[model samples]
Target: MSSSSKIRVIVVDDSALVRSLLAEIINRQPDMQCIGTANDPLVAREMIREMNPDVITLDVEMPRMDGIDFLGRLMRLRPMPVVMISTLTERGAEVTMRALELGAVDFVAKPRVGLASGLNELAAQIVDKIRVAAVAQVRRAPAASAGAIVHPHAGGAAAAAPVAASPLLGRLSTEKLVAIGASTGGTEAIREVLVHLPADAPAIVITQHMPPGFTTSFAARLNSLCQITVKEAVQGERILPGHAYIAPGGRQFALAKSGANYVAVVDDGPPVNRHKPSVEVLFKSVAAHVGRNAVGIMLTGMGADGAAAMREMKDAGSYNYVQDEASCIVFGMPREAIAHGAADEVLPLAQIAPALVARLRGAGDRVHHRI
Candidate 1:
């Protein structure tokens, strides 16, 4: 294929070795071709105008202009898929979230220096992210003439409005809980959805592939911003209405009936789909305990972890939704679910949250009635 048809990539990093390594890895892939490298955002800005690569791999730390600021300008002026390379630290996590909010597609944790194993892991993640970035939809930054302000509330409202109009809106029945599963790009994707929900939205349970310490902080952040309560799930905790319970990383979370109510069960078990808080485990439990009284949403992530469980939930009569390929940062999970006939509706990311809430509020009635 010609270079124009190939997955053209630009590598931007302060470290020469890291940039060279990334370039080598990207060029090794048949579908991906590294077009150029830049030492900093200043050079990167010029290279972007020249190369117009399909994707960019950007380091978080750089001199003169930080990666975050460059990302903000790039997304506003010329949006394209970007994958942030960050260290595995609290600071790294914080900056990574900021990058996502600024419209970066995903992130890869930089390998720890001097560790062969770490570098190998980083190589694998970089390759995967490059592949995903190639196909991801790059939304154009709203034109300045559009009078778009980056107001947090307005940004959220703009993101939520389309979700409310989704086809899933008219397909639901009674108010039931929604269970969502994701990894990788999930932090920002989930935020976009949850921030749009009403204060009285139905109960929600989430399993995001993450480490132990991260989920708590993520849940806290979501709680602070969202109208509904969001918290880390604990064993034996009652499932309350309008509250979202996120499964802690490093453990499996399952739902079980306790008398007239449902409670969360956190347990130690072998990882499913190479994930601790497996979406399959949660969806299976929801299928058995909640039956038809649940909504399963498989968001953007890698792997087919949630496919079978979503099928189980759908077979049991629960409504199911998947983020469409065009809106997914990584389409693996949702693609699998849809291919397995598990998803009842596939919607764009911008429309998923409000669509979910509307389904929970009886807008789904029209769908079933039509059936």
Candidate 2:
């Protein structure tokens, strides 16, 4: 890409130190340039008008006006991609989740203490998120209903009840499981798929790149809107049908079999592909345990984290699908999966859930629907 094609970015944070650090890192990227910096949303508003950058990195907690409120207005009006800078604290996690719901593309967590040391260690992450944001779809978020609203500040747990699992649907010899992975624009993409699943859909396991304290609220938000139960995976819990288990942030979530029943195993492990609760880890586990019985879907994300494991799943006889490039916010992962010859089908975002449903239904015409 040419210099004229470099991604333009703006940094907005209350801390002068943070703003300078972010600008330095962004400017260092060959494909990106920090066009401006702001100490608060007030200044950011004006800078956005002047700079019209491709991406914005906003701090969650800031003086004058918070990032969440600014994000809401920005999405409704200008509709630009944004990556949130947040503290790695309980309160920070709660607010960051709210920002995602407000249409922020992604977020980075900073340490509350040792801000300088922590931010230094996160240089690569900071730049990578900005890069992803630059290409992410920046659409206005749907208005939140009272029922879908989650009061994360009040507590970390989601404010919804789990739906009762429906009796086993098909009579296959082995139980069916659905495993999905996503990053970047995943929060909304996952919601789009989950909302369309029926109450009797097969069990689902998801690994969405998110920080701890945010996954619970994400699951809760889905639980409120979807017909099926959505919750953070708990150690040793049975993977019941009609329920979706989201891999909890900051932990490795894998699947294991307890006799004929599949179960979730949440463990501590080093980050594979530079991510804890990595999509690669989850998909590989599903391949190892569920094999041909599982349905593997890799959605839009910024990297090739799950592509190899998706190949493994295919080798093990599981059906696989990759989100098509045209529908992806960032096509890296899905493109990698397709390149690996892992995908049995490549479908647009609107078609993935229904196609999966059709396959599981044993629709005789599914062969005609393959793209």
Candidate 3:
């Protein structure tokens, strides 16, 4: 392939080892090439100006402008796809959540130990992200909501306080449930849906393609911005209404029944469609267990991880929503779901929450109209 045909990438990290390793991995891909490497944001700024790469792998901490500040500036001036390289630590996870809010396409958590081999082991994920980032939708970052409203000390705050919960939809059918799935640019998309849901919304089970350690912080970040409580799902817990359960990274979470009540079944199952906490696993479970009582939503993501199972959802009488291409960072999954005739509604990202609310309210009216 011609040089111009390859995806151009810039590696930015404080550690020389990380920078070199990332560059090496990027170059090894036939479809991608690392054009430059920088030890800090100041150096990276110049590299970006001169090289104008398609994607950048950035570290969270740096000497001259930190990655967050650099990312904030970059997103405003010349919004471009960025894949963050974060350490697998609590602090690292917190900063990564902030980076995603700031418009990063995705992140790769570098192992805390054995940097070289760890990065090699993750090389497949690293290059795959670069491939996705090259085509991801990267708009300017929304202005900082934390700095203006709340102090930015610790525990990454939301862009702003959540809007008040919508009026309670009283006594939803005991069987009603919501199943959602996403990947690639899922963090923000998931947040957009969860924050707009009413506090009394039907029980929500979510599968956002994220690895171990990150989902904990991701759930916390969403919980801070959402009216409904959000937490990582645990094994065998009876799922409750008015809360959202996120499948833990490295585990599979599926909908099941415990007599009359719904429950979450988390397991150490192998990756389905190359993902644990796979959307297919969750959607298939919801299809068989919840059937017509469930609402399946396929949000912005890359590839067709759950398209077939989502069709199974529709065949089982579940109503489904797939995010439209224009509003998605990568339309692969939603497009595939729609192609499979799974989506009952194909809507933009911004309109999805409102549509879901309206659908639920309408369904409630139909169920209780005689009263």
Scored by TM-score, the top model is 3
RMSD of each: 5.3, 6.0, 3.5
lDDT of 1: 0.79
Clashing pairs in 2: none
For all predicted structures, in order, the TM-scores are: 0.81, 0.85, 0.94
For residues 1-371, write the lDDT of model 3, one tens digit per residue.
Answer: 88999999999999999988998998888899999999999999999999999999899999978899999889868889999999999999999988887788999999989999999999999998998999987776545554443212112343344446654456774678999999988888888788778788899999999989999999998888677889999998989878899999999989888898999999999999999979999999999999999999999899999999999999999999999988788889999999999999999776788888888888788767856
Candidate 2 ranges with C-alpha deviation above 4 Å: 1-5, 140-174, 363-371
* Candidate 3: segments with Cα more than 4 A from true spot: 145-168
lDDT for position 98 in model 1:
69
Worst 10 residues of 2 by lDDT: 150-159
CA deviation > 4 Å runs, candidate 1: 1-6, 28-30, 111-117, 143-157, 160-175, 183-185, 211-213, 249-251, 363-371
Error of 2 at 363 (Å): 7.0
Instruction: Let me know the TM-score candidate 1 reaches against the reference structure.
Output: 0.81
Instruction: Using lDDT as the measure, name the better of candidate 1 and candidate 2.
Output: 2
TM-score of candidate 2 on Cα atoms, chains taken together = 0.85
Tell me the tens digit of each residue's lDDT in model 1 across 1-371.
Answer: 67667899999999998887788888877778989999999999999998788899999999999999898788877888899987777777778766776778777776566634565656766787787777776665432324332222123234422223233333132247789989767887888788777666667899988755567767887887777789999999998766899999789999988887789999988899878989999999999988788888998888899899999999998999899886776788999999999998899877777677655655456556678
